[model samples]
Target: MAPKLDIETYPGNIINNEFVPTPNTRHSINPATGSPLFKVPVTRAEDLDAAVEAARKAFKSWSTTPFSERAKLLLEYTDAIEANRDELENLLTKEQGKPLSLSHTEMDFALSWLRAFATMKIEDEVLQEDEEKIIYSTHPPIGVCAGIVPWNWPILLGVGKLGPALITGNTFIMKPSPFTPYCDLKLGELAKGIFPPGVVQVLSGDDNLGPWITEHPGIDKVAFTGSIATGKLVAASCAKTLKRCVLELGGNDAAIVCGDVDIDKCLPKITTLSFLNSGQICMLTKRIYIHESIYDEFRNKMVEFTKNNIKTGAGTEEGVVVGPVQNKMQFDKVKDIYAQIEKQNWKTALAGQAEESRNGYFITPAIIDNPPEDSQVVAEEPFGPIVPLLKWTDEDDVIDRANALRTGLGASVWSKDLKRAERMARRLEAGSVWVNSHFDVDPRVPFGGHKESGIGMEWGIEGLKHYTNSRSLWVWKKIFE
Candidate 1:
């Protein structure tokens, strides 16, 4: 049975282990229905200040607690979330417009991150050790850390930042996207009983709130997941306080389908990922490069698969593969691309209607066949259920075209020939390169971006260090004697 989307119990911002409401409030819109799901507190300057101060006060104790102890509390918090998993999933689907199954997947993804963080610890590194002298380095928490989460995968990405920030001994404050703040605030509500006061806080606000959190003097670091333009603004705002930033920005990821690949085996994976979350994912395969030898056959098959297998509707509907675009801003952006498609008279293997007809923000997936490399549909990250399939003949030429984009978040090469795929994967400019796979991220592995895709890393040991400051210590043996 599906859970109810009642948010009456989880109200307003979470500060110092209590729900703090503001006079000014805003309602979260459901992309599936274009209706107000529930009212969310519009965090004011005072609320931001209080949340920051609370985190600062909690930091004194949280930073000193043993890693094992902190991990224990986080584990309990995970349990609390598990107990209410159904509610979180339902709320997420209503707000973010992903299918209910995907919502469950996001919850599982978030819990896995918390569990992984619980098992990992940051220990002092012995740089040099001898009878004469000993030298080592320690990772100390960087005070209060802020996580600015996006709407696409609110819980999973929020936990991606929260787990590292708290497990490493830093008190955390989360700012969920205004478009999808319900589940995040509810998560914070669940945390009230598990984490100590001020150890974990969540504030939901409008556009103004992001600048406040980024520019806040009390926040020592910020981990942001959003568009490249917004990420730039975040980094610039944090520059004033010289706060550490871990940005996972946009990706014009390219998926190269080789002639040798079993088209039937790989078609489902490509189409699913290309339009997953309505293509709102930062690491989604925005550009597809198919070998000319099999391009025609592959394109037709992909179009047929999309026509036969994919269905768009509200997430609650059974057997719906794609949901509405998460919000109006994105829906409008994709609509603009539709205009571009008409203006240029480009060929579309599968075309969705551009006109707004449905009561919701639903968009059928579109696939442009053999569009020019410089066209908007191919060049820019549409971030919708739209993609371009281009033809590639020469290996070197194809690799260069795939790497031409300024953003390099993720890329993949598909081919049965292991040596050939491996060789091509090495040349693609991306933080995560895969062969016969896309978006296969693991908690044990470090995930981040290269070039303008992002700065710094998240997950794994490297990501944990981003929330900490490194300190070196040297002790002479003679001094102790």
Candidate 2:
């Protein structure tokens, strides 16, 4: 059963494991209905200071807490989330404008991630032993951490930061994007009794909140996920405090489809991947390079599939595979690209008109037919349902074209020939390369971006290291003998 949307019952920020309300508040609008979903505390500089100080005060003991105890708490928190999964997922769909099905998927992914971290342990490493001098290394939490989560996948991304930060013994303060703050704020509320005071906190506000947290000297690290433009600003702010940052930014990911592949088998997966979350995912395929031999066939099949299978509507509506675009800003951006396509008279294989009856930010998916390589739609990260399918005859040329962009977050090569796909995957300049698949990420593996896409990594053991600093311990033989 879906949970009720109750804005009046909204709880404020979670600071020191207590609900902290503010004099000022802001409303989060439901993208699907263009109506206010709920009101959240409008956190300001002073509020951020209080949250940071609380986290700082709590860090002394939290960081030193036994790993086993911390793990038990995290596991308990995971259980709590699971028990309320339906309620959270419903709220996520209402606030974030994703299909209810996808919202459930996001919840499942987050639960799995939390469980993974609950079972993980970071033990000291013995670098050298059985010698005159013994050397070992210890990974310790890096004080207070600020997790700036994006709206696209709020719950899952929030967990991406929370799991590592908490498991590694760091007191964390999360700042959810103003566009979607419900689930994250609720998460903080749910964790109140499970985690110690100020151990896990959440603050919600407008644009000002991010700068307050990032620029604050009390924060030891900033883990951000957003656009490349904002990511640069985050890195700059963190630099002022000499704080560590893990950024997962934008991607203009490409998928190279080979001629020998079975078009029937691959078309379903390709279309789904390309338009997953209405093509808002950072790693979703934005550029398609198909061998000229199969370009026409692939394009036709993909167009037909999209026209018949993909439907956009309110997230609560049944049989709706694609939900409305998250907000107005992104909706305008997508419309701007459509205007460019119309001006250029670019050929479109399939164009689903925006649904006007819904009175929301709804734009049908579009497939541009072989636009120029240098066109804005192809070069820039549209981060919308619109995507370009280009023709490529040569492998070397396609590889070069795929790598020409400033971003290298993810890419995929599709072909029945495993050896050939492997060879091509090796040369694709991306943090993750897949053969005949795209955007399938696991919590156990390291995930991040390359070049301007991001800095540092998240998830896996490497991600845990990002939340900590290594300390070297050495023992020297005494010469008293």
Candidate 3:
């Protein structure tokens, strides 16, 4: 049985291990039903100040706490989250519009990440050691760290930033996206019992909260995951304070299918990569290039698979593989793109009318067949269920086209020939390139974007170092002697 939601009892801004609710509140709605799920308490400017001050004050002790002790606390927190996993998944499905199974998957990912960060280590590196001199490098935690999490994968991304920040000894304040705030706010409430006052906090608010966090003097660093346009603003805001920043921004990932690929074995994997989370993931395969030799067959079979296998409905419904768009703004953007595709009369293997969907912001998944390179479907990231399938005759030309985009977060080359796939994957200008797989990211691997996609890395030793400042120690033994 699923738990019931009660709006009045829902949580508010978490500051110093307390629920600090203001009179002003925003309705957190269910994307599938377009109904209010909860009245999320909005954090005011003063609340922001309090949260920052709390983090700053807590930093003094947290930064000095033993790394092993911090790790223990993180593990304890993960256990607490696991205890409430079912309720969290239900809330996530209601608020984020992903299927219940995907919500569970997100929670699983979040838990694994927290555990991974807990066990990870950053040790001092000895640059040189000799009779005359010894030199070494160290990483020390920055002060107050703020994480700006997007709506798409709030819990996982929040943990991605929060885990590293806390384990490295920095106090943290998370700003959850206004569109989907319930589960994250609930996590904040859960933390009160586990962490010390001010050690972990979450502030829920409207658009103004982002500016407050980025521009605040007390925040020593900002780790943001969102769109390219907003990422630029975050970078600019942090520039004034010279605050350390780790940004994971937008992606226009491309997946190339070689002629020799195993069609029967790979179709489901490709479909999941292209349409999972309603295609809202930053690293999802937004553009697909199939070798011309198998283009027609692949396109027809993919369309048939999508039409027959995939189901779209409310996330809570059984067997729902795709759900409504999370909010109105994104739904509008997707509908506008579909309108353009219709106006251009682009050949589509499967095109559904988004406007015709019942009450909620559901856009039927559409697959355009061999759209022109400059076409909207191919060039822009619809960030919806819409996917573009284009034919590729020349490997070099296709690779060039894939690299032409300003965003390069992830890409993949699929072929039975491992050497051939690796060769093509190497040429794609993405931060993470894969052969025969897409979106197979591990917490131990470094993941980030190149060029306009993002500014820094996340999810590995490199990402852990992003939370700390580097220091060098040098000693002259001869002088001491």
Candidate 4:
């Protein structure tokens, strides 16, 4: 169960680096009980303008701060988070339920984000020189930026974007999803108390507000992580200003299980990744392509492992598996998607069931067997406790089939022979691939998608570049020609 929070005191956008509850607001409720989760202010255009102005004003000085100074402050922020890890974990569980273990790991992902991004070097490098002339390349902040984060991995996505953007000296306006607002607010609380007002403005608002932020002339850049539809709209809005963008969107990730792999060994890993955070993650594997030579045998082992091993409870617990769906809309999506899958003439697979006692929009982890490639379950991201499996006899045929989708975010290949797995991973046509692993990401590695998955990248050195604009300085030798 989520820890008790005073829902009445829910806050709003952190404008000008201060938390204020806007008169206009959106209410959040626990999916399990339909009880009040927390109320966050739904900001208006004026509110967005305030956030932008604050970020812009703050950016004037923030951008001037030396890289080492920013690095020092980022380290301080990291320490602040470490001081209240447990409290933040509670916030995560209350709003977005996953296993307690995974929640803790998410915090770890945040810590590493600060540590990794802060260590980046931004020094002027002289490319060519003459007696009194030099051509220099220097990276500087792009002023204020807007980061629209998704609900699935709130802290991870928010921090991943913020860490790099801020470490590079740009002030930020983070629009976190309404489903889990408290944690982001809590992050804002920490920042406002420590950093200069407007250095980091965290806001909460409805859907349309994102477009306003992107289109706002004050914002120099935008880094968004969400669905393809919304991402497209955001891209269009940013294009009006030609502001740089780093979009990381949807992923109907694929996992290829070869005949050579041991189903018993790979089953647990696949299930863990497929259902990580109840499959709400963008890069999570939603489609499983298995070799036909051992489909049935593999299914039996995988199904048994999934049925017996997965757990559903609050993330505060020590060994809980998947927790409640983030909110009712997600619960309905999971339900509707499963109903469609079951109604289809495709072969029936083992289905997940939400225990009657479980409340707050919880659903069983679904496993579809030998489903048709055309099935929506196959093509769409269920983004829930659901897994779809398809059998492929011809390797090239299946690879082509998986590559046919609009989303090519993350993918995996499980095989005893590492060479075969690597070959298939290369052929999979996605951003990042793992051998015998699913959705295992490190702060140091570049993570993004292929095709509609997104453009540009996040959470690596490449991510730092998102907050920057490169300039080349050329000086005349010997006082001009």
Pairs that collide in candidate 1 are none
Report the lDDT tens digits of candidate 2 across residue range 1-481. 2223333466679999888899998887888888887678999788899989999999999999998999998988888888788888889888888899999999989999999988778889999987477798989899999999999999999988999999999999999999999999888887886898989999999988898888899999999999999999999998998999999999999999999999999889889877878778999989999999999999999998998888888889887778888988998888888888778888888865544446688888999999999998899999889889999998899999999999999999999999999999999989989999998888778999889889999998888999999899988876554
- Residue-level lDDT of model 4, residues 187-211, one tens digit each, is 8777776678898888888877787
Best by lDDT: 1
lDDT of each: 0.90, 0.89, 0.89, 0.80
**lDDT of each residue in 7-81, candidate 3, tens digit only:** 246657889999888889987788887887778878888998999888889999999999999999999888888
Given candidate 1, what's the lDDT at residue 240? 97
In candidate 4, how many Å is residue 15 off? 2.2
Model 3 spans > 4 angstroms off: 1-8
Off by over 4 Å in 4: 1-12, 129-133, 314-318, 354-359
TM-score of decoy 3: 0.97
Count: clashes, candidate 2: 0
Order the candidate numbers by TM-score, best to worst.
1, 3, 2, 4
Model 1, range 375-444, lDDT digits (tens) per residue? 9988899988899999999999999999998999999999999999999999989999999999998777
Reference-based lDDT, residue 452, model 4: 92
